[model samples]
Target: MSAATIGGQNGAMPELITIDDVRSAAELLRGTAVRTPLLPCLAGDPDRPLWIKPESLQPTGAFKIRGATNALLRLTKQERERGVVTHSSGNHAQALAYAAKVTGVPAVVVVPYGTPQTKIDAARRHGAEIVQCELAVRQETAEAISRERGLPMVPPYDHPHVIAGQGTAGLEIAEDLPEVELVLVPVSGGGLLSGVATAIKALCPAAKVVGVEPELAADAQASYRSGVLDRWSAEQRGRTIADGLRSYLSELTLAHLRARVDDIVTVTEDEITSAVGWLAHNARLVAEPSGAVPLAAYLNRADELPRGRTVVVVSGGNMDAELFAKLV
Candidate 1:
């Protein structure tokens, strides 16, 4: 779902992309990007034979690398020289760090203090300087870092090039299975949702784009319905089990999700925990809460989905295993 211009402002972000963009991303990332497996649903929703695009198989155990790599690769020589900065919890930070490392560009990551230690080590392994701040102060921290370093900020999901690159996932899914009817994408700041929705809608007009979020942290769903950033009350947001869903909506991402997604559904913390267990125990796949969102949606509202072909984009697989073990 490529976003419309920011309130009719020109050059803020681009519109729906062309096939050439997907092909270009594929070409640029030919040797680097993993052709992650899309397995037949192990859960076997008998009504609709589902498929799981297990992006956990991707390098860094998440799908963010696809967009991050393409974004950094597409940069001009001057842009590359100045380096890049980003604010991310875990997945996107690893993705950007790996991308910058591969392209020989310096990366400074402003991470939330709550980010898992494993993720911090991963970023350090890729040579990204870590600047830690409180989770709620992400934008402010990232902005300060950008000013001090004079580096280009590589927003996780709000940028056009980033969205276009992420859309490649939907384009590939469509190419791989022309009969696909439903595609479930996990939403966070709405980058993957917007990109996948745009690609799916453009290619398979009849297909439904479903966005899933944790019920405790369903601010994106709220924003989609309200046509504005309807953030949760401070109390509710503070208690949501979905720590990764700690940010509010971006105007660019919110507009695209509302216009493109067929429906926005939510899952409880119990359902999310169950989904993670299902992936780990049944499918032998290690998945974080955000990664297991599709499974949560499927299990929570299996009867609501169309009784036809369905595809779920498993967004990431970066759980703190110890934390999950306690939950289970």
Candidate 2:
């Protein structure tokens, strides 16, 4: 189930990140990132007992820290001296800023104009120079900045190091719960899902790894089903309340998903908000809209999922104050 041999359309596949790559990333993230516990969900039935991997508990309040930190740590001293640049919707921006601060690597993040104030402010607080751009031109803006400033571009998800870093969480899950049957992960650019599915499939061969996303921004789901890399426009993706999940998958991530992931599912806007409130009330966890999508799938689409000890990856908790108040 590893992505090592996932064939490509050109009959020549680039080397996919492997379990050993994930393990190496885990070693790099050992002290910097939290080994988040898999807490038993109080809301579970006998047929499908539930557990939550609250990556929201990470230092930057999201699992993006794992990938961000790993990428930063792997950089050469000369590269670090030159600094790094990236573009992100929210969580990864904060994660990269926070990681850069700790490592004394100067960082600049090109964020879209419509990103939440909370996330933008958090990134600034971590000392990243924030550059605002239109949502559609974020990556291009970042690339221009990287070239002009002679800095490395640490992409949010497309890079192998980033995927391997995110895989650390899956490694933890397989180690902690050997008998786990289903793992529900939130999908945006597919960094978390790609790495997690790779690790989960390698460690717990029988366990199923499913990717959950908002129906409004379900390009990955569409791509998975069609066997082609489908993309939703910025206008289409921006309709989702899950700000952290508006980004589309990279070709690398799509390849990883096609090879390792069992299924892809989408939940409604109403279901997303409801799951946000449900986690706060039932589990006392503060899950952002993207983070809550996995729980939304469990609550609303259980009939379509595998039964047994299920693990839901709560990807982040960077909720806006007003939105959190309104939802919970």
Sum up the clashes in candidate 2.
Answer: 0
Candidate 2, 39-78: lDDT as tens digits: 9986777789999999999998999999988898898888
Cα deviation of 157 in candidate 2 (Å)?
0.7
The local distance difference test score of each candidate is 0.78, 0.90
Question: Best-fitting candidate, measured by lDDT?
Answer: 2
At residue 147, candidate 1 shows an lDDT of 77
Cα error, residue 96 of model 1, in Å, equals: 0.7
lDDT of 1 at 108: 92
The alpha-carbon deviation from the true structure for residue 223 of candidate 2, after best TM-score superposition, in angstroms, is 0.6
Error of 1 at 257 (Å): 1.5
